[model samples]
Target: MSDESEALFDKADTLDEIRDKANKNSNLEMKLRNCIKDSMSKVDSLLTRNDTTQAQLTRHNELVSFMKTYCHERAYSFQIKKCQDVSCNICTPIRLPQTVFDSLHFLPDPVPALDNPDHYTSFQAVYGKQTSEEFRPSLQLNQANAEPAPKSVFASGKIRDYIMCCDCGKWHYVYSDKALSQDEIQDFKQSLYTYDYSCGAPLFPDNHYLAELLFVCVKISCDTPMEILYYSSQKSENSDICYHCGTDSDFIDPPVKMVIGPKRPRFCGPTP
Candidate 1:
């Protein structure tokens, strides 16, 4: 995440003020940029109550610069890179914030927005700004016996164990540890991915508990021979149909893992 974005989240009140003013001026793009720009400036004053680090300060300027250039240099909407039917055409999987695709509304074909990018920060737009997948949290699982660290920005809790696929380079979270109850376990299970969405939570007294647990793909290797694989979901559909294949596969609790990840990777957990 950009330092400005990280620092700005807590300054909600300040963001609102600037956003209100920009909207009043009838400049929605300016409103968003003002919100983001004003958001970064107010973060320390309203939320941190202290100054940001020099490094962070530098990054804050960078995001502002990017925002400015986005409005100045390029058009908001554009073509998205996706799989093509053309045999020789490349179908590199480009995952952006759902918002990017959602804002434009999934059209008959994926076309770049005729609108401005500043108006919306789709999961794609925000995340796509990142340099590589390494910036993302890894789906690594430690030994079942090991204690978990703190969760990620959106999700929290001690992750006891997880699985990493060497072939496919996919990560799966496993919470079968003693720390998680049947309910908590179910919660994490149901919320495999789709963090921004509200309805995806593993519920209690789940009879067809298997009905939950969505498939979240971290990376779709074009090689077609990925070493590892895991599934996640954004909704609670009864069918566990594979994204690649429509066939419903039996949902495994521990996940039918033939491999593992690096040693004792830490996640959000109790303060040791």
Candidate 2:
């Protein structure tokens, strides 16, 4: 038997021990057990065959790989790692927070509010004035004068703008405009990336579409980065500016066709 097949058999043994003790449903346990048996039989048949071709060996490798993955995923569902699909010019797989993966089924589509100027206006009214000092905790340990990190100015469940870091090409977050709660911010302050007002822990479960607000491609690129006030709920006049490159349609030096971004994904999780 191949090394991979042997490793898979070891995994099967582990699963057998886990299956008996697991609090999982009996039906799922039976399904997993049967799957393991079927996979083992396939492996044994291949190993004992008198004339196993290269093609058969290749297929055996694939089968063993699949079985290993299946056993792990089914046996230890909570430990499954998050995966992402690449969807933009950046050509990098943006690893989403586990929060996003957990909420993919329940998150609503991006409300088309691009036309309502007030949506952007109101957003600015609330969060635009927040300063870095406000995000910091009290430096002095004194009990009486110590102040807490600022509470989020933006209300929960609000979608705002996307933040791109010009200094580091590492930004891919779709700013949901949802500020982390005071407690969350406090917790985040201790993390390595918490030097500024960045999220320390993985962004707790939020809508993935909130991350999709800024993944558009615009025809024109502008020198000044203007905030595009888009009210995603509006059906007409969705394009006041480029969500991708921050180009104002009105200020196009030479009038060009308005930026019509390709259909953005409505939900999060996988790109498709």
Candidate 3:
């Protein structure tokens, strides 16, 4: 009823109004949060459905096994033709001409004659004509000097076989009759386990034949079937064409031959 009492009642009314407004704002904020959460859940469900359809499409577009095999065969053939350098470990061993051996400053001491004539004949046959020709003079000289020949040099009678490695592109000379050394066997096994699919150019220079040969050796040694599988998905772009020869499933069209005719003179402007 008094002026101070009325002022206190008005202040209490203002505080109640403020509290009601604050409660309303809190309710609105909670509704907004729930709305955002529901919307996110719907978006995630849609994305998952879309991903499943896309995965199916991708599987449908993938290359089949036969196509993959065809591409690999073409690529392998092209690589072999391109990598015919003499330095290749898979290439046939080059026998230096007699002149080269003669020119060397430090040639192996001339092979002495064998006590058995049959052994000497067999050795000569194994060496081939050029080798026999190269050493014939030295052998005659040694015979004249009456030097006794050692039989141990050709006692084994086993020719050394060259083992070509695909991974390192190196040749290892080993006797055919003897088993591979522990280190050599371990090295082969290591290579088998750690074979690289991307080996090409520079050191290898497009040599895949040796790698195939090495894989064949692996199959024989382990008594397991091994194969190189090429997948189109591995490429940055999905393509069925051969990387080396630019060939595809379509047959190559023959080049068009153009016949050139004489050029006509330019016409002058009419009547200047």
Taking the tens digit of each residue's C-alpha lDDT, what string does model 3 give over 46-72? 322233454543453222322232222
The whole-model C-alpha lDDT of candidate 3 against the native structure comes to: 0.33
Considering every candidate listed, which one attains the maximal lDDT?
1
Model 3, which residues run further than 4 Å from truth? 1-177, 196-272
1-272: candidate 1 lDDT, tens digit per residue: 34554344445467576556546655443546655565555333332314457565445554444344322222223333333234422243336765664445211222233386334334554443323222222212233322222223112132343433333333343332246557855665554442322112222224544223322222233233221222222222223322222234442333224223321112122212
RMSD of 1: 22.5
The C-alpha TM-scores of every prediction are 0.18, 0.17, 0.12
Q: Is 1 or 3 the stronger prediction by lDDT?
A: 1
TM-score, structure 3 vs. true: 0.12
Tens digits of lDDT, candidate 2, 160-233? 22333343212222233445566544443343243222222223223432222212112112332322233232
TM-score order of candidates, top first: 1, 2, 3
What TM-score quantifies how close candidate 2 is to the native fold? Answer: 0.17
The CA lDDT of each predicted structure is 0.35, 0.35, 0.33
